[model samples]
Target: MTTRADGRKILVVGVGGLGRAVVEEALDRGAEVSVLVRDPDKLARSVDVRRLAAVTVGDGTDPATLDRAVAGVDVVVSGNGAHKRMAREIARAVKRNGVQKLIWPAGGTNAFADDGVTPAYKLHEGRFPGARDIYLAHQGCIDAIRQVGVNHVIWAPGRMTARGARSRDIEVKVDRSAGMYVSYEDAAWVIVEAAVTDAWDGHLVSAATQTGG
Candidate 1:
């Protein structure tokens, strides 16, 4: 599939497992990629940081750092965990900088299920105490993105494995009916594809690997 990321300036916040996968895929697709990280040395040790277009060191919540990172970017892909404050800050920066696209990883619970109730959300409510707060916070982040009026895609990959080979076949659903778990690599592929494509723009997609693939 043609991602249309060639020569595009893409900013990735948080270079952890999923973030690293995103960076690699974005680079593979020929995007001019930059990363914003708190620990430049740690990221340097993991990947060939020298290949990146730029690497700015600072906290994601820092407005000045975000401003610097977001400048002149075509799209922003943030895999900075579930911190509402960080999401808010990134959304603000994207809007303030007039970036056109934002791709965020909102958990499976955030995607509405076919039965009209998100299964993970019900699980959090029924079993995990205080987990609802996290869900609500993620919702707040989604709200911020929507309120900003930028074209966005919220990727909801429910349960993800830390390491695995990338799958050639994957499934993506607008509803929460996709598979339960996907490899980090596969999730990253979906995210990068979504970032550069308009198929899922202004929508939330649930992505997972196909079984027995």
Candidate 2:
């Protein structure tokens, strides 16, 4: 079944790789889309800014900027990661604006189900030694979101690949222990799908592609 987002207002924060994908998927699903980007020029270079409902230029950590961005929006999709301060600011804006639905990707190391370490965390630790502090900082963002008391979904994806097409065989698991590889496209699809629908509302979902695609 095709999920439609027609007439819904969505605000996408941080138009990076993941953010860009979310915007595209949401647009494809017929949603009215807007973006909160620090660098409007950079976002324009990558995406057709004219297709967006609105584009607000400011840092995600700024309350004033977030307040403006979250105004009159139905759902807020956060594409930011590893920045606890930014996440806290977004949560505050969500509460202030009374936006009910929020969809955020978990920090690569943060586990939504249990406190145990995950393969994705070990992968990051091995790739970049002395990065434990960075992981903890991102995890702090997830903690902040949980305390905000908003209807939200945290889509936890493992090592994301940019090399393959999205697979329908992707799995959404409630358990944190799942496969450690998923395509960026698939992860983005799941995030946007959850934003438009209530399938994963108020839950922490771990998603991964079955065949590494």
Q: How many residue pairs clash in each candidate?
A: 0, 0
Best by lDDT: 1
Per-residue lDDT of candidate 2, residues 1-213 (tens digit): 658889889999999888888888889889999999999989988889989999999988999999999999999999887677877778888988999787877744554334454534655676778446655765677788878777788777767766446776777776363555677788877887888788888766677777644
Model 1, 1-213: lDDT tens digits are 646579989999999888888898889899999999999988998769977999989999899999999999989999675777787788889999999888988777777767757545665566767557766767778887777677888887777875556776788887464755777888888888887878888878887877542
**Index of the highest-TM-score prediction:** 1
Report how far off residue 212 is in candidate 2 (Å). Answer: 7.8
Question: Residue 94: error of model 2 in Å?
Answer: 0.6
Off by over 4 Å in 1: 2-4, 116-120, 123-131, 211-213
**Residue pairs in clash, model 2:** none
Error of 2 at 133 (Å): 4.9
Candidate 1: clashing residue pairs, number: 0
Q: What is the C-alpha lDDT of each candidate?
A: 0.82, 0.79
lDDT for model 2: 0.79
